[model samples]
Target: MRKTAIIVGELKSRYSVGRALQQNERTGYI
Candidate 1:
């Protein structure tokens, strides 16, 4: 269970970083 939680957390953190980068690109385009 603990390992599963860690894996999920890592995936979420990576997703958030990618999302933030996309948003930054959008802002720059605007």
Candidate 2:
């Protein structure tokens, strides 16, 4: 359970980062 929680947290964080990067690219922020 602990490992799963960690993995899920990492995945969510990574997904949010990817989304932010994409948004930035679209808005010409990067």
Candidate 3:
């Protein structure tokens, strides 16, 4: 259970980062 939670957390963080990067690209921030 703990391992599953950790994996999920990691995935969520990575997804959020990817989304933020996309937004930045759209706005020419990166």
The model with the greatest lDDT is 2
Which candidate do you rate higher for TM-score, 1 or 2? 2
Backbone clashes (count) for model 1? 0
What number of backbone clashes does candidate 2 have, counting pairs of residues 3 or more apart or in separate chains?
0
Going through the candidates in order, what is the number of backbone clashes in each? 0, 0, 0
7 Cα displacement, candidate 3 (Å)? 0.2
Residues 1-30 of candidate 2: C-alpha lDDT, one tens digit per residue: 999999999999999999999999999998
1-30, model 1: which lDDT tens digit per residue?
999999999999999999999999989953
TM agreement with the true structure for every prediction: 0.82, 0.95, 0.93
Predicted candidate 3 versus true structure: per-residue lDDT over 1-30, tens digit per residue: 999999999999999999999999999998
Q: RMSD for all candidates, in order, please.
A: 2.5, 0.4, 0.4
On lDDT, the stronger of 1 and 3 is 3
Worst 10 residues of 1 by lDDT: 21-30
Rank order (by TM-score, best first)? 2, 3, 1
Among these predictions, the greatest TM-score belongs to: 2
lDDT of candidates 1 onward, in order: 0.94, 0.99, 0.98
**Using lDDT as the measure, what is the rank order of every candidate, best first?**
2, 3, 1
